[model samples]
Target: MSDTSDRLLGETTNERRASCQVAPGLTFTKIESTLQDGQTRYVRVLSVDFAAFTGKIRATTGKTVKDRERTSDMAGLMASQGLEPLAAVNGGFFDIASEFSPGALGGLTVADGKILNSAANGEAALTLGNHGTNLWIDKVWSQSRITFTPPGGSPSRPDHVVDGLNREPGRIQGCGGGMGPAGENDRNSHPDNLIDARMPQLGIHCLDSDETIVFTEDFGALPFLPGTVRAVLVGADRTVKQVSDTTSGLVAGPGEHVVVATGSHAAWLQTDAVVGSQMSLPAADVRRGASAETAVYFNGTDDAVVNGGPWLVKNGAEGPFDFNSGTTPEHAYLTPMNSRTAAGITTDRKLLLVVVDKKSGPAGPAHGLTMPQLAQAMKNLGATEAVNLDGGGSSTMWVKGALANHPSDGTGEERYVGNAIVVTAK
Candidate 1:
């Protein structure tokens, strides 16, 4: 840890009321009030200033679906890494009812600087940089693609990017890769969702400039290999210049960045990707999903972004919304439903995570806020820009190793989820 990280980890300010230094530049504020309806609501807001601490603030997905840990149990995950759980909230949408749904199952998911799953166009998404710095929220118009070039040819950006990194966890609870997990191909087989047939399951496998694959399978049946996988090589040109069917070790030259994708091949092979020749993947056409567009998320070397709908607040102005539209937005941006979650950046360039708690039951106080109310609440909090995240029963927050709110699941339990935005002091 640098001086900044040290200062942030060690600094404690006890002078504030209902607020304290949860992390370096991070502050926790709780707002409690009783409404005229005799309902009491609880709101815990995390305020972060990027300047104080010296580490990283990230939105990371948990283990793949089959081997998933309870997302509401942020403390357990934090303990596994020997980290302090500053705060955490569920992430993205997924095949909630399926046991075989893969981890980071749906929406756009990029963890630890790797693009594990691309966003669907029209869907909302959040993108981030590798260092967990640059942050963006926007409406994703493109899913994902692979553009590559051979030894010497105009950039050959392929039309398709690999669909995923593994089998659907919702479809097959223990669909491990290799000959061991026989149904790996059978789970979640779609034309769009894909994993390399040879690699077994799908995932984002990283490689350094030297083309050294740095990944080890945690749950899937596939064994870890340095270069042999569904890997794409990014070179000095910063463009993916090559795609390999079986192994990145064969395609990547020394000193190149590598990325490996996993998913079912039944869906991915639809792209007709090639390797011997030159190729480059251009942004694919944006497709609309059942309710809205599928979102995209990315972790670049220096920025992060997630997008959905028109800007809620930018430069301190509310963009647009219709409280009485009598209909939900395509992606439910302004839904009046309760248990809404929002991520934002303050005008002063700080990070904000807000979860509006809904009244748990007839006896609970806060029922949660609607679209317009949620947006306005963000504005009042001084958020210059923000975007809505998956909520409803998915809306739960964890701090210091415990759920900080009443989960609407009624089971008094954390919903087992595909992914989560985990903030840590590591």
Candidate 2:
């Protein structure tokens, strides 16, 4: 953003100064509600100078339940990371109420550039990555597609890109598959049932591509080649968004073929795919109308990156980000109320981590702030841009082995989670 644009955030940088600075750019402050009845209602806020500590602020899914830790015991999991945090919070929605082994629901996640989960096409998202010189929040889009046009024939295309490479039978409505099959109502679908699902969704990862594109499902300690692999036909709409999903036996003839798999269009999409030749799959959301080479004619795969969110703030003004609205009876349901955790950027280029304790009182501001309230609080903190992370029982914060917020689970208790955002004193 330009200097003049930064000034538009109302020049409230450091509006509520931190009481202490423990690291280079990490500071902590205790904010009390300025209301008469808000005497007992307060929040713990942490601020980081993103430019000063570029690459230090990050989002993480601490550990995968692998079934054992459907919710990795939160506090225990944070302590295991070994990096102290200026403040931390639960991240991304998860499979807390799903048929599959619980973990991060659809929040795209990539640590060390290793693809853990990929966001759904055009889903609400928040991203943080380096622009070479500085690590800053980014706006990235995930597009799912496997396109191919046969010789002198029509083309076949799939609309969604699913994460995780598990053909685990039984699909949940809005769990890992995303808000598509769920039909727009963010909270309407039954967590454990499959309603309008596309059958045999094609999965792609680097492994599914030419050996030239290395697949790094378990890229531990390995120099990641994220850009090297343009798009991996990782998994279908099942488990995680990052690896090779169950393949729908693509038996091929030496000559040519074309196929398209869409859940909403038809139950079964069968066609032939020519061996050694598919359409070229390219990156997404890079520019307006700039699509990956969709006509590699079945020669492709799309990228999966970052976590999901209901963007709270943007470009020095309120953003139009929502996960709930316009439902088709099949995808409308009530959303749960709980504590909230959010991330934002200040006018002066600082990063803010705000965690509002849940509503415990019978009602009113005495209870915690609702999503709208949280957004206002972020604006009050002088944030020019912000996004909501996973919250509720999953909401948490850690600092040098000490828990900062009064976790709602119990008196100073915590709920295990699939992931956590950490602050290491690099």
Candidate 3:
């Protein structure tokens, strides 16, 4: 790494620490401490200084629901792709259980500039430019759309909005997307307990009667069994190849996409989307809450993005929790002390992957940390902006060729996550 003294948080100080340089610009550090309450805390951080780092820090997601992989497995996959795996941590929240299709992430996700999934409302996500040079943490919104024109139809007609990319239609996992006329955020086909005010409509399978979802080759084959859902298959040439109501044995071929719709949307396809019609699927439009610039720059721009929330710290302090009134007893989601994984960027532009170990075994004395505590920890580590990633049993850290933290999973095994943020050197 660059000067170790300058990069670290001053190791010679009061905390017990173990540090190692994983690569030219990557360093892994572990801090062990006993809180005033006598609980032990284990904190692991993977600090990346892009100026000295020779690789890229990007997000990786599976192409299929059954493709979920452990943190180490993801690292191995990166290695197989010819990039040296330096460090990695679990990504955003996802639908671990879904009656339709499991593993649909809760928020926006992009890998190597390709939009894997759009944002979940205006959820906070940690965005990074190629080579980890540019980074932004903010609430973002995005949507995919398709345009089709008949032989004699006007080309100026409006484009049809795509509800989701490569995911089950209408069955929103995390309840994202903008509110509709009825103030419905997403169709909640499987609403369970109210996770919190921020996620009242959240569930494993939020259903919508009429919606459109686009499926690309990235999703592998169509993930649905026998169902009433209808789809329009479009070739790379932008021609409608076929329209089928059959949900079985269907897959989007190379440079092709399948537009799957339900209810009235299906009817629109059966009519307007007849065989031989012209169609075009453009890059998704994404916008950051704080910027007027088109967030679509994130698509295919050599940048990497991953989903996370709510904001732990913004501009060097605890940020706003507009979705939840932290003072209310009903909003207990952020108050509990739980194992946490957070992604942050320092004022100087250095990237930080922070993982807090919960008291899963006798060796780990830390009972985890509350959201506020996690924010304070990120601030203490010099992060001017940060957001919490998927944690709990999913919180994991892999570095220097192996798992580096005690996964809070009771058995100590890492969970198969929807995605991960990894540092790799080509």
lDDT of 3 by residue, 1-426 (tens): 122333222322234667888888888988766555666677899998888988888788754632567877888888888888888999887777754455657677777777777666556788987676558887677766677676666444347777777666766655654522122344444445344322322222355667888877776767554445678889989998888886556778888888887876776776667788899777777777643244447535558778787788888887555453122233454777888999889988899999988866456466687777788888888899998888888899998688888888776688888888888876
Clashes of each: 85, 38, 6
| lDDT over C-alpha atoms for residue 214 of model 2 | 16
lDDT tens readout by residue for model 2, 146-256: 343334555464432322321111222123232233223222233333432221111111111111111222211112222212222323221112211122332112211
How does each model score on lDDT?
0.48, 0.42, 0.72
**lDDT (0-100) at residue 241 of candidate 3?**
87
Top TM-score: which candidate number?
3
TM-score to true structure, per model: 0.60, 0.58, 0.87
- The reply for model 2, stretches above 4 Å from the true place, is 1-18, 65-86, 131-140, 144-306, 319-337, 359-366, 410-412
Using lDDT, give the best candidate's number: 3
| Alpha carbon lDDT at 371, candidate 3 | 77
What overall lDDT, based on C-alpha atoms, would model 3 receive against the true structure? 0.72
Error of model 2, residue 369, in angstroms? 0.5
